[model samples]
Target: MIELNDVHKHFGPKTVLHGVNLTIPKGESMVVIGGSGTGKSVLLKCILGLMTPDAGTILLDGQDVARAERDAFLARFGMLFQGAALFDSLPVWQNVAFRLLRGSLARPKLEAREIAIEKLRRVGLKPDVADLYPAELSGGMQKRVGLARAIAAEPEIIFFDEPTTGLDPIMAGVINELIREIVVEMGATAMTITHDMSSVRAIADKVAMLHDGIIQWTGPVAEMDASPDPYVDQFIHGRAEGPIEAVR
Candidate 1:
């Protein structure tokens, strides 16, 4: 399980996370939802150790992540960045096999390429696409490549940032379903940050709402619509007239 105990973060004079607390059980898909600037990404970054919290503890299976060995600790986690974040210079196979090509999980070049092709197939891409570059694929195909890369190493945990950000609704739905399938098949602990309600309904086993520097509400996906919290209702329903302020 992952636990955050009164975690806090600040940027210069501005506070982002204020005494935040949440827990995600092993093998569950937890999706964080919130408006822009609500610290949704910050929370993910804090957990990933990409950003240091100013206070409190972040524990993964009871061990403090901040104090763990960097390479060894990160080897168990995979990340699918918001923009896919594939290396433009590398082929799709190389991008998917990036983790398998180095560090603790290193494998031979040919073996890595084979593993990459397998993962690509798992995400609905063909082996032929593996030799192409990221710039050569459509946005949806790029997302599939990103998803393939994320699961290539078979990590125990995965983080997805805005998994459906730039796609059309149909493509977004496809990506969402793909993510749900991969997470279940791997039985991996998954944490995603996204504002898309369709994505939430498709991917989240549990949903968390981050607002005002804290987790305002959290529960199973089934409970989200009936949730009494105004923040959650306003956000999920995309209402501009509730507790959340709308800019003029």
Candidate 2:
């Protein structure tokens, strides 16, 4: 569903994502694991066309992303940001229906609301919570709302950025399970970037280790633990004494 071939991007003298290459099959979950500053987010932005790449091509469903119509290309995607990143001013239902109530994907107000409520329920939230504001909810509820918004448009591709960040371990686990279930049920191609191993184990069918601006190791999740690559070993095991240098 997605492919990156020799993708390269850099800012001035600093380079990130040097020759990133990988392929994600249709309707599968692929998680990218890497340390901070490894340009995981940058890679995502490049694919989304938010940032122009210095070199290389990104293809979505066999067409170059750069050449695709922006609205149509982005319409195929949904994103769950690192934090819930909810709009404080909007009520929960409105937040979830934000896409459906706007350009390209717009629907009748009542239909959009119904879809929002259903998506909220899919992420394990009750309808009563829909009328409330983000501040009225707990962290878990807010995250659920984010997930609801992500799938509101029924996008063909979903990108999760640190989906478990800022949650208690139990809540994180809940989110991971929800993500895994939803992606499989919807048959959407999933790409996630996260440092959480629990999230990786829960959501990933394939694991890609990105380091030094390229993919160091990539294979089925079943092979990740037993892989012999030093970079993969250091990352999945959280070692301070391997190929990856500790930030501190």
In terms of TM-score, which candidate is strongest? Answer: 1
Worst 10 residues of 2 by lDDT: 239-248
lDDT of 2 by residue, 107-226 (tens): 899999999999999999999999999999998888899999999998999999999888999999999999999999999999999999999999999999999999999999999999
Local distance difference test, each candidate: 0.95, 0.94
TM-score of each: 0.98, 0.97
Clashes of each: 0, 0
Superposition-based RMSD of candidate 2 using all C-alpha atoms, in angstroms: 1.0
What does candidate 1's lDDT look like per residue over 113-160, in tens digits?
999999999999989999999999999999999999999999999999
On the 0 to 100 scale, the lDDT of residue 76 in model 1 is 88
Candidate 2, after superposition: displacement of residue 239 in Å?
1.0
Q: Quick one: best lDDT, which candidate? A: 1
Alpha-carbon runs more than 4 Å astray in model 1: none
